[model samples]
Target: MRLKPVPVEIEKGKINVDIDLEEGKTPFIVVYCQGEAKITFLPEHGETKVVTHQGKVKRVKFDEGEDF
Candidate 1:
């Protein structure tokens, strides 16, 4: 359970979040879009997706928050 501060960029109508993790480490991302922005994900079993490799980039269809 570590905390990281990552920068997000919004382009067109999409947002991108990136992660940099060490070996044998995993992360859980929870994002909530604010204002006139809306976001969604596929295969939405949104919770506890783990990353288990060093310098590995894993993608998941995790959607846990809502926008207004």
Candidate 2:
């Protein structure tokens, strides 16, 4: 069985993402949105690592709304 990836818009800054899913092939929810999103997501434990999206793809961890 398979499920469609839900489309979501993450604002620039700290946003809490608490959702559960089965362990297997999963689609990314950020691809729908354009630009460099500095998401501090640690899939290991689902811990909250807040970071901002910077202009550069390398610095995508800064809170500045712009496509890297």
Report lDDT (CA) for all predictions: 0.38, 0.33
Q: On residues 25-61, what C-alpha lDDT tens digit does candidate 1 reach at each position?
A: 3434543333222222223333534443454434323
lDDT tens readout by residue for model 2, 1-68? 12224434456443344445565424233322343322232333233323335632222222324344
Given candidate 1, what's the lDDT at residue 33?
A: 31
Lowest-lDDT window of 10 residues in candidate 2? 55-64
What residue pairs are clashing in model 2?
52-61, 52-62, 52-63, 53-62, 53-63, 54-62
